[model samples]
Target: MLDPISILNLIDDVMYFPILIIVMAIAGLYFTFKTRGVQIRLFGESLRILLEPPDKEGAVSSLQAMLVSTASRVGTGNIIGVSTAICLGGPGACFWMWLMCIIGASSAFIESTLAQIYKQKDHKGHAYGGPAYYIEHGLSKPKLAVLFCIFLILTYAVGFNMLCSFNLQSTFIDYSFYNPTTTPVIIGAILAILTGYCLLGGGKRIIKITSTVVPFMGISYVIIALIVIIFNIYYVPSMFELILKDAFDFTSIFGGLAGSCMVYGIKRGLFSNEAGVGSAPNASASANVSHPAKQGLVQTLSVYIDTLLLCTATALMCLSTGIPITPAVSGAPYVQNAIGSVFGPIGPIFITVAMVLFAFTTLIGNLYYVDNALIFLNGKTKPSEKFMRIFHVCCAFIVFIGATISMDAAWAMADITMGGMTLINLPVCMLLGKIAIDCLKDYEKQRKMGQEPVFKAESIGFEKGELDFWD
Candidate 1:
């Protein structure tokens, strides 16, 4: 009889493999065309507006939203997930990863634009929205919205948290001086305390924390990776050649196994940037921007930063160091070994610091996503402080347990939920793509007219005041 993990793996193989891949590719291309390649055409505007201060009084700046979401995207997935893709799929997987990011940027723009279009103002005057809000309000399908929220909470908030916790614990324990048993427990306790403190303050606090941490941590890691890459500058051309060749080469690094390249590329790419999977929209909806399309454009840049910049940095480091790609030496350990080969004694220590920051920020960012889901389920009523406190405590406990558990089971559970969540999100984004397209058109028109763009639901055929905050 198949155990639970085996069952989940089988279901994932059947459900997520070609179906999700094809759908995501189609959705990305369709959104790109529908919006006239907004991700590329408006690239300068996205960066320009990203630097603009928070204009609206109630919501976080678009930059804050991007950073918070980036905090989640740039986690163990970039480090460990990239390594897994190379180990299973070969160096060519990096090319596919880049392809997914470029194509999927359009999907990010569409969903994020729709998220802002349909966003609601809580009683406290703070904004919150995501696929759930847009699905119900934009599509008038509350049941499907509820189902999406459930899957999102399960996949991101709980399942992915466990996976991150386990990764963080294992990396530290492997490198630390203490006994593995006691070290994990101590780490778990510290994680719980720190996470609990952040969670207690709610969304505003999370934005503040992530905005500060994301840039510092991201730049620091990239700097380290760049140093390694510069040292191996001569190998740069060969690395690029191998990646491109292996991507299309029929024989593969392991004879006739080239197909795994596409599979792992798409899988790890989705895990890394989270472009069409509907997660970033949750954070994007919280931004206060002159136009909904502004946040959308900002989010499109995030996919590039995550996969093209950070994940690529990790891949180049490993490939440049000539780390043997073997199953026995993969994931975080593979990254550690590569860094160790470059910098010697400081390698594991550097990775430990990087993983801790990456994983911790992911934990907080994920908690915000789940918090929005809980808010949706609880209706428009403001959750009492006590209820939120209980929720925070539960999150802390999950982090603690996650730090101590077996990662195989944790990741299996995450894959099941991630696949289910994507299945729900992809169809909904396609259904609602028109609204975002129209909003992008409106934004462009206003920009060309030398006016700052403002959105009205009525402009898109919605009844006046249909949106909570937008006119």
Candidate 2:
């Protein structure tokens, strides 16, 4: 019998490489052509629209939704995950991640737009939708929707946040001299309390918090990275050369582990941006926008920020530092040493602060997905306050336990759960891809007519009464 870790790796192997990559890549390429490269052509509009305020009395602003999902995307994965990829797959991994970010932006747009088009009001009377809603309402398959929701609850609600906590705790243990056992306990308790507080405040609070914190942390980290990169400007050319050379030269990347470079690159990119994995749509659905594509465009920008900017920063910092490749030199240590080499002892401290902020926001963002899932499970009825309280408490307990576990175990658990989610969601997204294409055409038509686009269910061949909210 396979051990638990081995079993998880097997699941990842089965799902991630051939099917997930192909399905997502095709969806992205199809939409990129479908919209004439919306991610590139609409770049300025995305930024301008991002700064616009939310609809009056809307549940979430487009920016807030983007930030909330980005909070989850730009976590320890950007830091530790990048290092792991480069160490295992060589510098070539960065190129694949960039490719995913570029192409995956289209996938992000399609999924998020469909989310908005098919959005329905929850029991609380606020807008909500996701792959589950689209699957149930569009394809008329409630059971499949339930299965997808279960995957989401397992991935984000339970296992994913545990992975974040584990990374944060590892940073604590690695950088500080506190009692290992006591430090994690104390940190876990504090994190649990904080997480419970945020979860109880509801989705509105989650969006607001993420909107504020995500930008601050992201900008600050990027600025620091830019400073370091500037200081080491001479190494930039060599870094690019290494990435380009090793990208196709598999023999140079993996001495005996041949063919694993592409595998690690794609896996890490999927884990980082989550473009076609059907997660961001949940957040996008909550936003109030005149057109579904507006939020779609906003959510698409998040992929660039996650992999292109933040993940790239980590990759360059690690590569430019000329750090030795070894098991011990990977993950958080790799980042710590890279930056520490530039800034001295304070470098590690800087990374620790960034990790805590990024990981904590990720924990909160992960819970927001679960909150939406609970709303889905309730089936037009709002979750009771008592039920939500119990759920929040359970989540806090999970966080505490996660913080106390070994990093390897937490990561394995996250990979297995996330792989299950990708397996379920990518196919569903493909099934619903055409709806998004039609919606984009409709949005563009209205734009050309010098009108702000508004979605009408009838325009999409749905009777007024068939859709829950978009009448």
Candidate 3:
């Protein structure tokens, strides 16, 4: 029998692509106009919040929340997905990708603001909230909230995060010394060890890990890309022309180009930033702050950091370096080749190890997201938490499948699933956005009256509530 996944891929290409992309783009566009460029105006404010997140009351510091969210946001989409777009869509894909970031940033910010507004303390007194909570709390639809949580548990935790583990382990095998079949076994063992360590400390530990590792890998990739870019500095001018040519050249001369490339660029950009997908909001809800808009703005600014800054950096490094980007063998190796062309084999190897690191952090971060959704259902079972560790183990072993599967198809299907999730999330954000604005105004009003900012934790913390570890 044909692979069950193969059947799913066929269905995705035929059905998922058309319906999802159009809807996400339209929603993004609508939010963009409605917000009147919060992404632009609040960009500086977002950075300020990130650099100095208040730490007295919220579940986590604002910076930690942003980092955990970014750890997830910045993964495969930045490194591999950027190359995939350039390969399939050509040089011009970068422009469309930029467009997507502008809008997606707005979407993420709005989603985050809403999440902050609807945040609540769980039975254990941990602050818990997200798109699901907002859907139920803000809209007064608890049934829909449960549905949202279930979808998230399936899409983000079990499916997307597990898929990331597959990316990480397989990349190590595919690009390194280990054989593909054997690598996952080794990787799986390591992941089991690491997962146990990280989960023991919880989201705070995961953020601490990713916050350090992610920026290092991203900077290293840029450094390597820069080495290649310097060698081909003369080719830089033509890159803009090439990108425009592919993006706008509508002729059959372009062979289903233009629209095709634009779609891919936008699709990949959306996938990378994940603003409308509602994943980032879960992270946002964790921030300890009185002003909901503070985290909203910070989360929104992350799309710029992830896509516009980081992803664009990858694209420029590849395309401007004048390496002949081929469609057939697309991925980090292509990015590696673009750099290695100048730096030699070391470039690819550097990318190889770095991607493994980046993917690994994402694997950890996405699992945290998955854990959050699962908590919503099973209500934070020590048993459920233990079970979730196995959830990631299965994902780690699934890494081997990466070697056999076509990366393009794997990513394309991810895009489709991601798009569907975005559609569910976007309308909720738009409708609930007014709530965030009101919350922002309320916080501002409090600030004007010289009230100290406080959140669920400080207001009803175990200390004030007469609760303890046993209680």
TM-score leader: 1
User: In candidate 2, what are the lDDT values of residues 1-471, reduced to their tens digit?
Assistant: 987766766666667666667776777787788789999999888897798777667568999889778877888899888888887777888898898789889888888988898898766777888988888988889998888888899888777888788778777655557687798888888888888877777456655665576668778877777777887889899999988988888675445432356667777887889887889999899898887888988988999989988998888877877778666766788888888888888888988888887887888778778877877889755699999889888988898988887755776677667777766666776787777877878888888999878888777677769878776
**TM-score of every candidate relative to the true structure:** 0.92, 0.91, 0.83
Give the number of the best model, judged by lDDT: 1
In angstroms, give how far residue 336 of model 1 lies from its true place.
1.1
What lDDT would each prediction earn against the true structure? Answer: 0.83, 0.80, 0.69
What ranges in model 2 sit over 4 Å off? 55-59, 122-125, 176-186, 197-214, 252-259
Task: Write the residue-wise lDDT of candidate 3 on 1-471 in tens digits.
Answer: 857676765655553356656666776777667666777865766787777745565558778888778878888778788887788767777888888788777778778887876677667556557887778756777777677766676566445655565555544533657775566667656665565455555556665766687688888777776766787889888888888777776662246532367767877787788878889889888777756778888887778888878898889988877777788646665677777778787777777777666766776667677667766666534345567667655654444343345454466457556655676788787777666555555545565688644433233222444222112
In candidate 2, the residue pairs with backbone N, CA or C atoms under 3 Å apart (3 or more residues apart, or in different chains) clash, namely none
User: What's the lDDT for residue 23 in model 3?
Assistant: 64
Backbone clashes for every candidate come to 0, 0, 4
Question: How much is the lDDT of residue 93 in candidate 2?
Answer: 84
RMSD of each: 2.8, 2.9, 5.4
**Model 1 lDDT vs. the true structure?**
0.83
